[model samples]
Target: MKIRILTRIALLAAASAASFAHAAPAMVTEGILTGGNGMTLYTFDRDAAGSGKSACNDACAKNWPPLKARDDDIAGGDYSIVMRDDGSKQWAYKGKPLYFWVKDQQPGDKTGDGVNNAWHVVKP
Candidate 1:
């Protein structure tokens, strides 16, 4: 009976680790891209897609916080990583870097859309 219990515990631990590895930092929420916390994600028009870099930095990054990614985080599907001006990693989708508006106080808020005709929420 003890051996059976030990085997079951090992299986559960392996499954949990696998789930974390494949988990995406962002997901489609209400038909739009949102962080794991459900906050809306946006893209800047000034950021050239597929550049592997983010144009929003310094003061610009203050208002629109980049979707940060850790060194261990893996990118898959339409998700990718872009190096920031500070040499940090950020999450991107389809080559466009993702960000969050500071004014958004709660999840599902898209107050950052169309800001200065540049910022827009990522769809799908």
Candidate 2:
């Protein structure tokens, strides 16, 4: 019975690890790109794609914090990274800088969308 219990525990552990890997730092859900925390990700319409720049900075960044990228993250396909004015690496989708709205209280909150007609939800 002890051996059987150990086997089941091992299986559960493996499953949990797999889920973490699949989620990684970002994932698509319900046709929208979301942060690891499941909060809605958005883009600034004013930011020019491939400019390697973020228009939202200073006080603006406080309200719409960029989805920061880790040092080990590699840009590929539609997913890319941008260097913020502060020299931090930030994740971008299809060349649009990604951000998390501070007003969003939880996952699936899209209060930042269409704000001032500049911010929009990033769709997968």
Candidate 3:
């Protein structure tokens, strides 16, 4: 009976850890903001802060993909959710929509920063 109780406690701990992991959509890495996948995230200048909308859409989104948020994801503190033109949910930091550059091949790559003087890497 004691062994069974210990196993149940272990399972509960694992479940709690998984829930906490999904609480944050992104994390700071290498002095720059990155998605849960560790790819560098950026913001567009055209996007108005706290407007709750993303200016990058259609063809623009092809190059800079917005950091998508799950339907069940909750926003807190400096992080929030914005609705894309297609009605998709996106994660934002300090009201600025976060995105990933298509040219970025791996984690820590900020190649898309300063693209056309509009995009910039998100700095924590």
In TM-score terms, candidate 2 sits at 0.79
* Candidate 1 TM-score, true structure as reference: 0.83
Task: Answer with 2 or 3, whichever has the higher TM-score.
Answer: 3
Which model scores highest in TM-score? 1
Q: What is the lDDT, from 0 to 100, of the residue 94 in candidate 1?
A: 95
lDDT tens digits, residues 35-113, model 3?
A: 9889999999999999999999999999888899988777888999999999999999999999999999999888998
Q: What is the lDDT of candidate 1?
A: 0.94
Best by lDDT: 1
lDDT of 2 by residue, 1-124 (tens): 9999999999999877654543345688888889989999999999998888899999999999999987767677788889999989998888889999999999988999999999999887
Considering TM-score, which of the candidate structures 1 and 3 is the better prediction for this target?
1
lDDT of candidates 1 onward, in order: 0.94, 0.88, 0.91
Per-prediction TM-score to the true structure, in the order listed: 0.83, 0.79, 0.82
In model 3, the Cα lDDT at residue 18 comes to 67
**Candidate number with the higher lDDT (1 or 3):** 1
Model 1 RMSD vs true structure: 4.5
- Cα displacement (angstroms), candidate 1, residue 5, comes to 26
